[model samples]
Target: MNMSIVKKLKALHQLALSLTCSALLSLPLVAETAWRIDTVASDLDFAWSLAFMPDGRFLVTERTGQLVILNADGSEAKRQAAALPDMFVAAQGGLLDVLLAADFDSSGRLFLSYSCGNLNANSTCLASAQLINDELTAIRPIFRAQPERRGAAHYGGRMVQLPDETLVLTLGDGFDYREQAQNKANHLGKTVRLTVDGAVPADNPFVNQAGIAGEIFTLGHRNVQGIVYDPQTGQLFSHEHGPKGGDELNLLSAGQNYGWPVATYGVDYTGARVSPYQRFVGMQDPLYVWTPSIAPAGMTLYQGALFPEWQGNIFVSALAGKALHRLQLTAGKVTAEQVLLADLATRLRDVRTGPDGAIYLLTDGAKGQLLRLLPN
Candidate 1:
């Protein structure tokens, strides 16, 4: 044992300890912070979707027919948005989600989705309008699902605006219409891309197709209630409600077949087998599948500087699981999962990373609330 060798070994041990301490410092401190549930002065009437305005306020949509504004401190709430038109407030319908345009600060524009009805039929409609002084004006239907008038479920009413300035909207299979999901002629059970003003994007997958051309971006989705575009990777991610046991999270791609009734991971609500099998040729497999279904609703990829290490994580809100699931990923594959607010026992409905870099969540219930998760 040489004296020089001993000195070298001791130095290496010290270096290892220093590295370990530094790694610990970089880890998230989610457990250290006391989550303050601000119940007072909160008017979240079954709020579904939430988007932060550039001025630090939040625009939220209720499952009913109203849009409310929440101040930055959550201390004040008011009905800033006007009542929507022809909203079919039946089961799984009504006002679904709301989003502000990328240039909303200057344009004062916002988008909304809801089930529309008149003449004894109901259909899902995507509408856009100017939000002036908390009121919607110049409202126009940008897109509408075809073969309308089915049962009142599976609207798939969420919007994701891509960096290319194009907007994509999801539509469900319009209950009892399993075959429509595979039909390219209809907007039901499909993802459609359009311009900011509801015009079809020239580069859409079906831009030049024979029929139903210029709208269909992706086909064969079943009630995709959650959709988000990852800015870092420029990838689209969507989550949908399954019957009793087969909820799923899918990576969206243009013209790709995401087989719904033909190839599902879950069974029917009656406890009967829906799809013959989970895998099939040409069908895109989900990045993650939930067995005994979590009933996922909303999601967003974290990219803020508030939590540097959590920048790339995918945060999904689970209703049946009653928690927010954080998934760590590398190269578009999930490597680990952590369940947050598991003890809260609240059905987490929507999860989004705020402009302030904090994670905000909406709980699901008749009198649900808005929660913020900040790093301690």
Candidate 2:
């Protein structure tokens, strides 16, 4: 590349970053809502995710390494412990995500993403188990990140199972291993797809390629926390926590590289530039970026009949922002943004759309509460 051209590209990148920051920071921080709340459950110990069953019952994962079954109204049905073998409970690691399988009515199997190993050596993992007669049984490990890097943060344990029954999971860059995101030999900073039995899908983007992890579907993520599929449109969306100000909402596609340390909309936490490029060849840009950081956790697509007006909109749970974010979308593009539930004034953890067309939410902390939004 010529020197002059390089300088010009750098200048343009800086300008884009400046404009993005201004547009984001200037938005009004107004909190509004068009729904009423109902407390479904309380005193959950740092609840991370929930799995809803067809029988009006659900399962919730706690950061303390336990899974609890609850009734439709959030009453305790049972608690299942010792399911996550060799679980590592520490900062940003631990029992992370719980999701039910499509054949749950008969197979009784479910999936989980969690942290494994001790503080000195840890890694993100995926496991399967069966719920038989109110107890978790037949728990077995299916997958784990390669190399088992050390560090307690950046586990990135969000997951979604497609209608075809293929499982997708997100893994983080291990905080100290940001550079490995560009290395295909490892699973850092990547989204992976696997079969229900933990086998590598033959059609996976990188399968059969020498020196690459066959499970990886996409690479170059920072620390993804939220991923949801829009069944109506057949589109997948995910959001990741940025270093300082570059939190992003992306339209996910297989084999796409979403630049992280190499090209970011935000800088490092120490006020230094993360990279000099905002747009790079062969790298996909985010559909939406949250400057100043919202610390996104869970996300869901609204196709509910309860709020017909919000059909096809995206709902994201925010931790640092302490609000529920509603992003209006059209043809996979974010058209507008709105903030809801700011009055709650507590860190929000996960958001979901219930079968009844209502919105479900989980708050953060040791005594967190599960909440629901009903049309007023």
Candidate 3:
């Protein structure tokens, strides 16, 4: 063979090999999978909140006051934490949230929030319990609402442990009771800081006050359901339920008043304008406002390897919208927004980033589902 011809033949072979390798590398992209709902793992009962154990098991709370332990693979469920105190379970009451203590491996401690008493006279309660194999032992009510009364619904129950070793609890003002939201004398409509054992943090906003619970860290929230700490800045961001339209996302500040009944960007369900947009002279404005109201429930800021593109974005479960809304953030400001799972249209109750770097969610329903989201 001629030297030039031999050289050309070798080049052609090299080009063909490169093309084949490219095709093989692209195969997985073309064969990507879709998100599937795990109906078998879910139930007719309302699964409200969930947290993962260090061993990968899940401790999930049902709205009816039952705590169940679910295997990692979505099989072999067991009741781990039992004998949850009696709950209101009326409009929005009942077992609200369950969280594993940061030191659960050593302490066997779990914190929870729920409403106690009947529909007409219910109040929010924050309690802690020790999980012993099959039951919750030494169940202790750490903080009870001041001037307890009876009513159903609206308990903001999200727990996040701050860098200060203080637990911040989000609480909702009782249904339609906007006045209580601004009152510092009570725990309603506030985020509180407490010790793991339910003791008041001395640096709390109202610790020096005579009548107020010293646990309050920040006051003036309506129905804050979503609370998360930005690990980057050590700041807490919370999202709350709105009346007809004006849902709010707030960067919670210590000792700051968040205008609720006094100021609002939305109105009442009957179409009456709520408190003026700027009610109090010193009230803080929401970082982001949802005019149509997404009805956000669970919230978490992403920091995982599975989807590096989603880092620093806020994930919120939308109930009325029946979708998961992703808000892009830069320096604590929302720069862009996107909605996921718009086709299924199921009410997304809670969203959390699993230890496996995958996104797991619980749907709201009599037969709600636990779903895992992956990159397509």
For model 3, which pairs clash? 44-366, 120-150, 121-150, 122-150, 122-151, 156-172
TM-score of each: 0.87, 0.91, 0.87
Task: Give candidate 2's whole-model lDDT.
Answer: 0.84
Native-to-model Cα distance after best TM-score fit, residue 71 in candidate 2, in Å: 1.5
Q: After superposition, how far is residue 149 of candidate 3 from its true place, in Å?
A: 3.1
lDDT of 3: 0.75
lDDT of 1 by residue, 70-148 (tens): 7887755568544567778877888888888988889999899888885357888888988887677888888877878
Best by lDDT: 2
Q: Give the whole-model CA lDDT for all candidates, comma-separated.
A: 0.77, 0.84, 0.75
lDDT of 2 by residue, 48-161 (tens): 997788888878899888788889989998986746877899988999998888888898898888999988899999999888887888899999988688879999999998
